[model samples]
Every structure is written in structure tokens, then in C-alpha cells.
Target: MMGLPANRLFCLVLLFLFVPAAVCGASVTRTLSTAEPGAGEVFTVSLSIDGIDLGGVVETLPTGYAFAGTDHPDDRVLVRGQKIGFAVMNDTAITYSVTAPASGSGDITGTWEDFLDETDGEVAVSHVAVDGIETAAESAGEKPAAQEAAPRFAVVAAAAALLLAGRGGRR
Candidate 1:
């Protein structure tokens, strides 16, 4: 009886040893061809991800950018709005072209979730001058120009109309 139990325990140990370990933890990186890309200029952006499963990567970029092409044409790519997801195995290297918007900058953001774990990170894209010769002046905590200017313009117009009405009444 003792020998039979020992033999079963030995088999269990060998079974555990032969099983492949699960891959844990994932890392993602984003790189741009030019440090500063101008409007309408298509630049190359590459994404290298490691330690992932067969279908566990999702990437998101801000508006005004589109996926021109990719290195791994075999890999499936799905895009919705600003987000892109991939169903791939293990590791992958993707090089794609991105056309900058008419104005401003775009940042890359993504999250990876698999049966193993979940991770997230962001990549800040650097914007050069429109001419591509100088860096644009950017203020810390300042919002995008297209988004910031609209509300302020409405307020200024309303104030100007009130002032003009007061002047007309005085006249």
C-alpha cells in the first residue's frame, strides 16, 4: 500500500514538471519615425509588444491619426474610432504609417488584458513646428487649441455684444 501511494506522488511530480509555464506580465512600446511630425506628413510608428497571449493586445491613438499600413499583414487588425486591437500570438513587431492631423498633436494610449493579467500605459507624442524646423511652444497643462478656443470665443463675443449695447444706449 505504501509503495502504491509513493508511485502516484512521483507521477504527479513528473506531470507538474512537464507542463509549460504560463506567460505572465506584458510590455508595450511605441516609437515614431520623426521626433516632430508636421501636418499632412505621414510618419512611421512602430509598436513592439512582448509577453502576451494569442489575442490580448489593444491600442488606442487620439483622433486625427489613421493606420496607413503595418509590418505584419497576416496579423488581424480591427479599428474602431481611435482604438485598434490585435489578435496575435506571443510577441509581435508592427510598423505602420500615420498621417498627422491638420493641426496639433496626437498621443498613443493602450491597455493589455489577458487571462494572465492586465496592464496599461501611455505614450506622449512630440509635436514639432508646422514648418518642421522648430519645436512648437507648448504650455504645461494647456489643452488642445481646437478644444480650448471655442468656449472662450463664445464668452468674448457675448461680452462684446453687451458692451456695444451699452454704448448704443448711451448714445
Candidate 2:
């Protein structure tokens, strides 16, 4: 490692640390189309799964909500004990819409399970809250705020430091 250049060593270190974790480990992310959903209104919740075959998924909707459908239709879809399940395979993302029932607040729980071996470590669970039911403000349908600009000072400083180091080494 000492014989390698600084940038090369950094790249090697990062590759060794992150590549296996990214390839072997499964990751799940959940997103809500609307944070505040009004009662009896339809909303979309999406789950993105990576590095897994994604054999099945279970979602527990809030008391006042019901699963409408998914982007990918499944014949074996079932609903029991306030939980919905569907069989899927090799899908990168599954998006489903749910209808909010009478005006109320509740939580949605979701879990992803693998069909094959558990040793592959392909499982994830997530929960999201549904609030602001029956609110006049929520009915207005407010969108999320835009992201702020990232700071450029660090990039410029790094470039300057690299230039100075190069010049000093050349001297």
C-alpha cells in the first residue's frame, strides 16, 4: 500500500470496503408520495429493493387505509390480519397505491422477505407514519420543499490544495 500512489490507495481502500457490502447486502428504501394524506384519498407508497430476488413483500396499512393495487400485478395477492402480501421475484422496485379510509391517522409497516436462502442476508423492514388526516391544510396538497444548493467551497479548497501540492513536489 505504501508503494501505491495516494489516490490509488484511497480508491483501493474504498473499493475493498464498499463493494462487497453493496453487492451482497440487501437494501430497502420507502417513499411517500404525500406526507399528509386526506381521508378517503388515494396515495402512493414505493419500496425500492436492491441486491435481492425479492420473493415476497408484506405491507400493513393504517386502520383507515386499504391497498388499491401495485405497479406489478400478482395473482397470489392476499390480505389477512390487516396485512397485505404479494409474491414477487427479481424486481428492482415495487410501487403500490393505497386508499385512505375515513378521516384518521395511523402508521404503515412494510417488510421484505427473501424466498430462498436466509444466509444471503436479504431482508429489510420499514415503517412510515400517516398523519394530518382530514386537515384543510393537508387537502391543499403541499409538495416537499426543494433541496438547497450544495456548498462549493470545499471543492475549490481541495483543488487549490492539490495544485499547491503538485507545485511543491515539482520544485
lDDT for each candidate structure: 0.55, 0.59
- TM-score of each candidate? 0.54, 0.55
How big is the positional error of residue 117 in model 1, measured in Å on the Cα after superposition?
Answer: 5.1
Best by TM-score: 2
**Candidate 1's TM-score:** 0.54
Best by lDDT: 2
Candidate 2 lDDT at 99 equals 83
lDDT of 2 by residue, 1-171 (tens): 233366545554555554444344555567788856665678898887775575677777766577888777667577775698767678788788888766655556666656563422212333233455333433465433432222243334445555544554342
Error of 2 at 25 (Å): 1.9
Model 1, 59-131: lDDT tens digits are: 6765566666566555477777777776656656666676766666545565554444443333333343333
